[model samples]
Target chain A: MKPIFLLRLLVIAGFIGFVEALCRIGIIDNFTMPPPSRIAADLARALASGKFNGPIRATLLNAALAFCLAVTVGITAAVVIHRLAALRTSLDPFFATYYAVPVLAFYPLLIILFGLGSAPKVIIAFMLGVVAVIVNTLNGLDRVPRVLLKSARMARMGWFATATQITLPSAAPFVLTGVKFAVAYALIGIIGSEFIMSTDGIGFEIAFAYNNFDNATMYPLIVLVMIISIIVNMLLSIWEKQLLERRGLR
Target chain B: MSLTRIEILGPILVSVALLAIWQCAYWLIGDIALRSPGQTVRFAGELLSRPTFWPHLVETAKAFVAALAIASLLGLTIGLLLGLGKTAGDVFEPMLIALYSIPKVTLYPILLLSFGLGLSAKIAFGALHGFIPVALFTMNAARNVRPIFLKTGRVMKLSRWDVVRKIVFPAALPEIFTGLRVGFSLTMIGTVLGEMFASQRGLGYLLMNAIGLHHVDVIMAVTLMLVLFAAVISFALLAIDRHLHKRF
Candidate 1:
């Protein structure tokens, strides 16, 4: 494990060094991209400058809101749908094909309805993420052991009590999987919508900088977004692994 | 209704129900920004009949096909190589996942800078969006091939290419195909998105153009067409995917 980890680090550092050499030697060119060292410097300056604080906060806040909404609404919808055999059966195809559909295509319509504010972006993120949560939660619910439910019933547990005590605990890992996807989707939705048409957010800032040939700002923001997303994803993955291990499900 | 009957009727019922809701929304919004389902269908027909629409459609199709081709070929090769290396696969899989989850649209500027504002850029962006999933799926598929099968090939003294062709390739084909299906959808999206942001042609460009013009009818029409195209192709691919999964 340690050897593999060291190898991964070496690979990453080597790639960055290669890029740095390219930029320094005019192979990639400064207009196209900056060197890793330059990008790091710019990132530090940007972070300390406080110029991007507003957009960063806005994007993160909206993404968080979207994630929360998707998880709550998705789990609720899945629970309801799980109890209704006909509805679940009828919705199967929709769920299967849902991700294939470009939910972003509806962004224009959302803007029309909600105006050019953060609402549209949040809605898009929620729409993109909620389905994954629903589908995974439903899968988890379906796999809950019937014997466990029977024991709960024997213990005189009510439906809500049984769910909170037995069903949810058993299904936590799968739900975490859904939550993980939701995190990615929410960020994608918020950033993608901002990229397409919005006045603010990190995506808009990048686009704005790009149009003006401000590679300094654009590259650093791009790097920043990459860092934030990768960190969030890694954290969630760690938690998910721990949860699975605890449940002996890994 | 019976299960089979419900299976046949379910999607259609859902479609109709959705259209009804859409029509109701149109009635409520009253045409300043919305189009009724009937109106959207008729407008889409009109747009399809127009010669101007064909160029955009053709451009998008060309980009999508090119991107999917590159993504599949390259992704499969890389994934196969990594999967063959146990340590390499373990080290790189998480990196690939991180790449997969990042909001790739933000990288459009870098693509635009390197590839420029053209078909190449669009194809590159589409391929970037598509390549990871295919690679990830293919890696797992190849890595999971039963060791006994390879052992038998080794005992038989089969050549490397022959072993792969006769055993590993066939064993991994089903899952690889699933990867292709997903890669196909994402490529379409990425190509369209590329057009939306950078290009002067394609259905995505048309959608963006319509938004700028506030041509609500055209927006609805193009969106309707894209959704129909995606849903039909996805269902077809899903059917094949299910068949393969079941057969294996």
Candidate 2:
């Protein structure tokens, strides 16, 4: 494992060095891309300059809102669907194909209905993320030991209590997995929508910068979004592994 | 109904239910922001008949085909290489996963910068979206090939190429097909998205143009067509995927 990690680090460093060399040699012209070191430097200055504070805050807030909405609503819907065999069966096809359909195509209609504001982005993010949560939560629910539910019923526990105490705890790991996907989806939906059509946000800023050939601003902002997403994903992954290990399910 | 019957009937029922809900939403929202299912279908038919729409359709199709080809070929080659090399696979799998989760839309500008604003950029973007999943799935599938089979091949004094061709290829084909299925949709999405963001021709461009012009008819028609295309192809591929998995 240690050697694998070292090798991975070396590979990454080597790739970066290669790119840096290419940039330095003028093979990869400045117009196409700056070097990794330059991107990092620009990213720091972009953060320290605080010019992007507003867009960053807006994107983060909208993503959080969408993530929360997706989790809550998705879990609830999955629970209800789990109880109804017919509905669950019928909805299976939709869930399977949901991600394949470009939900971003509906952004125009959403903008029209909700107006050209953050509301549409949030809705798009919610739409993009909710089905993932539903599918994963449903999967987790399916694996909840029947014995646990039987014991709850035998103990005269109510549906809500059984759900909160028995089902949810048992399914927590899988739900966390769903939450991880939701984070990625929410970011993608929000940022993708903003890229397509929006007045403000990190995605908009990237697009805005790109249009003006502002490679400095554009590359830094792109790097920042990737760094933020990767960090969030890593944290969630660690938490998920811990949850699984604690449950003796890993 | 049995599970098989429900599986067949379910999607039809769901489609009807979806159309009903769409109709309801149309009535509620009125004509300002949406077109009804009937209107969308009619407009879609009109779009299909229009000669001007063909060029855009052809352009998108060409880009999508090229992207899928590149993604599948390159992804399979990389996946095979990594899957055959234990150390290499271990070193790169996590990196691929991290790349997968990143908002790739953020990287489109970089592609545009390198490839410029044309088919090449669009194909590159589409391939970028598609390549990871195929590689990941293929890597896992190849890595998990039965050890006994490889040992049998070694005992037969087969060369590496023969061992891979006669043993691993057949074993990994199903999962590789699954990867391709997913890659197909993602490539379509990336191509369309590339066109939407920056292009002169394609369904995506038309949708973006309609959005700018506030042409609800075109937006609904194009969106409806794209969704139907994606959903139909996905379902078909899913059926084949399930069949392959069951057989293997």
Best by DockQ: 2
Clashes of each: 0, 0
- Residue pairs clashing, model 1: none
User: Per-model C-alpha lDDT, please?
Assistant: 0.91, 0.92
Q: Which one is best on lDDT?
A: 2
Fill in the DockQ of model 1: 0.75
Give chain B TM-scores in order: 0.96, 0.96
lDDT string for model 1 (A6-48, tens) is 9999999999999999999999989899999999999999999
lDDT of 2 by residue, B1-248 (tens): 13687777887898898899999999998998899999999999999999999999999999999999999999898888889899889999999899999999999999999998998999999999899889998999889999999899999999999987889889999999999988888888899988889789999899889877889999999989999999999999998998899898
Q: Name the runs in model 2 displaced over 4 angstroms.
A: B1-5
lDDT for position B143 in model 2: 99
Please provide, for model 1 over B83-196, each residue's C-alpha lDDT reduced to its tens digit, 9 standing for 90 to 100: 878988988988898899999999999999998889999999999988888999899988999999999999999998898789888999889989998998898889888887
